[model samples]
Target chain A: MAKTVTQEFTKGLWEEIAPFRLVLGLCPVLGVTTTMENGIGMGLATTFVLVCSNILVSILRKFIPAKVRIACFIVIIATFVTVVELLMQAFAYPLFLKLGVFIPLIVVNCLVLGRAEAFAFKNKLIPSVADGLGMGVGFTLSLGALGAVREILGTGMFLGMSVFGASYEPFAFMVQAPGAFVCLGLMLCGMNIIGSK
Target chain B: MTELIKMVVVLVLLSSSSGGLLHWLKTQTSSKIEDQQVKFVKGPALKSIFEGSSNDPTADRFTLKVGETEKNFFVGKFDGKTNCVAFEGFGKGGYGGDIGLMIGVDIDNGSVLGAAVTTHSETPGLGAKAKEDPSFVSQLKGLSIESPILVTNDGGKINAMSGATITSRAVCNAANDAGKIYKEIKSQLTEKVKSF
Candidate 1:
């Protein structure tokens, strides 16, 4: 049976997760996600770009030559990234600063290009859009999970809201770069275990 | 020749578009971006000092004036009694970069109330440990005002994180300098009060 648009959308939630399941976009997943909000913001912004870029690339797929497809895709992705960057600065200035260079770096995030080439170029417009949404949500969810663990342990708080009172001690290493790896490693392992079941 | 021209055209189009878009973005977002970065670095520092605390009336800095010297600080009061002066200072040689500390010192007793690392680029597992372990920081509490600053090896007070000597020294010095500056400022203020 042919896959439905909804199936495409749902697949990214688990089976096709950009970082967790697919192992794509590992750099940003492991970086710029010290806080839950930062992770959410980055994930959602990436998703927005993925969805829009996929749709545009798919629509223009036939018009572009195979030899220069990568260049074309990059130009499209970069434009969307600029748009996302500007919008975030205008509306979500604090989150934008927290994201730092990661916002612009999204242009090279492999997941967007991977989808555009593998799925968007071949699939219909609706399926490509769904895939983008699914992947984005999956990425967002994973980042939020990573952020939750880091934030809570790192500063005894969640999303800047204190979960642990003054008496509660925080583990500072959990918020550092090493902590990002530790958390992501354990999470990926957990995801694998659940996926096997 | 047409193909070469087409390639050049594409390249130029791509370059101009990207450059134009980036320039537009910078123009639109530079102010907000600057404001956001300032908030990102300073917001938490402010919260660590003033959140969940009150200002002391007798404190001159509480009125937000430092005279010509132009230093800014916050006063924390508990039950109308001046509890602490949240003072900030920096250390020159931390393991990573300059370590910034916000220290709360008791106004009456002149002892430390608490301390927080407001900024640091210290190595994750090692130097950053200063911000974590309370047992390490508890060494600073109730220590006398004279030479309250120390390293674990020197035995004055304050436990140092193992293998993070530079960071340990930096934070300790920061706390010490903050306390010392507060004392100097407080004495000056008192002299002014006496003269009046």
Candidate 2:
């Protein structure tokens, strides 16, 4: 039982990330992540929503009938997402605008709903929370990794801080939309290579 | 009968509670969000154009008679100086849908001081970079009314992003449109000020 718990906690790190592996929630992952700051902001917001929704869904799992389960799950997820959105606005307003609607759209993020239906509904409270945390971290890392690549090559910068001197012209396209796909695909490929080994 | 009642009750409670929670949350955060919006995005975009000014964004729209064309726009003024002026238009469609940009123009001159993505459904990295890149935006600064608003590839002043030709052109086009309006405004205002 303890071994299974540990696996659930760690599984999100590599085995079942929303992006890269399962290939879920690609919109916000790619949309807001032009810089490391944006990626971190988006990651933490999504994580907060995931953890809260997962716990709520798990607690109400038995009470919620299977036919209405998805609707119940959406309501729970939307509540947590609103909280996350409000919290970001209250405290991290700059990051909030930077993130834009992607924050509210967390309600529909496959990762949050996926966890509620997959692990949270089936697991106990502690394990559900653990799974959410693990998955959130995995998603965050994925966004951060993608942001780092785009920022560095596209602008010779990282997280808005300029790393290169005036000599650099910066590959302007690397920060553009095409660069986002190329970077994400290459990163996923790299992750695949590492995982295989 | 019992099961149906229970299902109805549960859905009612769930939806009402969710709506109530969202309403409460929005009420609590709306003011803070508006303040932060001024402090961060709008403020910074304006500061990049005008250095520093108290951010007081008015939704007031103005029609500047630029020759025959009457340009309408939202002006962000800081302490009497026009910090930034924002205007919107559709971009050439690409892999992403229509790209919309809010160009912030500096008052000292009609130069593009800063800009932001008002609306976009562009592809993840390529077209979206126009919003994310300061370099792409920076090129707009210090731009005079005399400068042609074309990309470097097309023998223009601004640099276009690799693999994002259509997107880059779209942005450059907005800047050009704004720059043209600015020229007419400058000439009109200068003549008006001289007459006074």
Candidate 3:
């Protein structure tokens, strides 16, 4: 089947959904999803890096020698990550502080590298951009959902505002590491259920 | 050998181009980035400590060369005199490595006006509570850090934050260090405040 450019973009929303279907890039997924804000911030940052790296990698694929391709990819990816890091630090210092080490850690995210190697290196520019945006948005949505669920359960709030009422005690486990794993597991299970239908 | 040389050239070209691009971006945003650091990261702590001063401390800030590198000093003016300063201090936390806390010192009295955690990476609910609990930060506000500040666990006056002894100790120790640094550079700081 000849895949349309739209397919490249939309598949990542669910079919090739990351941290679920693809099961890639779980580090930030589990670590930074303590708040809806953190989750969304991380998602957007990843998307920025992914989109730029994908487009750059696709443009330079022909010029790049296969022998040193991975190294080349790393350099390009690292540059964009640094740019994001600096911009975030200057303009979004509060979010930057909240996200902490995870911002720089985006450089090593498997999803970014995987796209660079598997798709961008072989695709045309428009499709590569679409794939980056689609995948990045998908990743952001998943992480944001994880954060929203965790924050609501853990703190009885969404984005730090009271949600479940004063009488309801927050289920603290949702914000902890154990909560992250369990929540991710249940989410993946739910995704499986939907996929089968 | 020829192929290897070409590969080296490829790597070099890619690295140089990326490096150049980053260098340019950094130059464009460096000032704004510095402005954000003051406005957000360290601003709250500075405001909390230097509250009600006649002059804006952040705007009246300066840098002093200490040890090897330069350290920033945010000055608060009272009655047109720069009398207070705030700067970042580092402490070793239990889990997430270095903890950064902003320390505000009264230049004349040599007392810590107040403190706020600018950055930390300890366990979220436990060690992180150190930052959340205002009392923990307030405890250091009026103390004379002439001697090393110790938590109750180490047999001193300050109460260690519940369930976060190591993080508590780290912050106290860092605050104590800030005091010592303040004492060490009192004369030099006084001279710099004149410029501010």
For each candidate, report what fraction of the true interface contacts it reproduces. 0.30, 0.61, 0.86
Candidate 3 lDDT over residue span A1-197, tens digit each: 27898999999898998889999999999999999999999999999999999999999999888999999999999999999999998789889988989999999999999999999999889999999999999999999999999999999998668997899888999999999999999999998998898
lDDT of 3 by residue, B28-143 (tens): 99988888888886787788778888877777788887778788889887778776788888886556887788888777777778888878888989999877776788888777
- TM-score of B chain for each model? 0.63, 0.56, 0.87
Q: CAPRI band of model 1?
A: incorrect
Model 1, TM vs. native: 0.59
Candidate 2 lDDT by residue in tens digits, B55-102: 433234455665575654555556765445655444555447666556
The most accurate candidate by lDDT is 3
Q: What is the full ranking by lDDT, best candidate first?
A: 3, 1, 2
DockQ of prediction 2:
0.43
How many collisions between residues are there in candidate 2? 7
Interface RMSD, model 1, angstroms: 2.5
Clashing pairs in 2: A176-B125, A176-B126, A177-B125, A177-B126, A177-B127, A178-B126, A180-B125
RMSD of 1: 8.4
Local error of candidate 1 at B151, Å?
22
Candidate 3: give the clashing pairs. Answer: none
What is residue B85's positional error in candidate 2, in angstroms?
Answer: 16
lDDT score, candidate 2: 0.75
Ranking by DockQ: 3, 2, 1
Q: Give candidate 2 regions above 4 Å deviation.
A: A1-4, B41-196
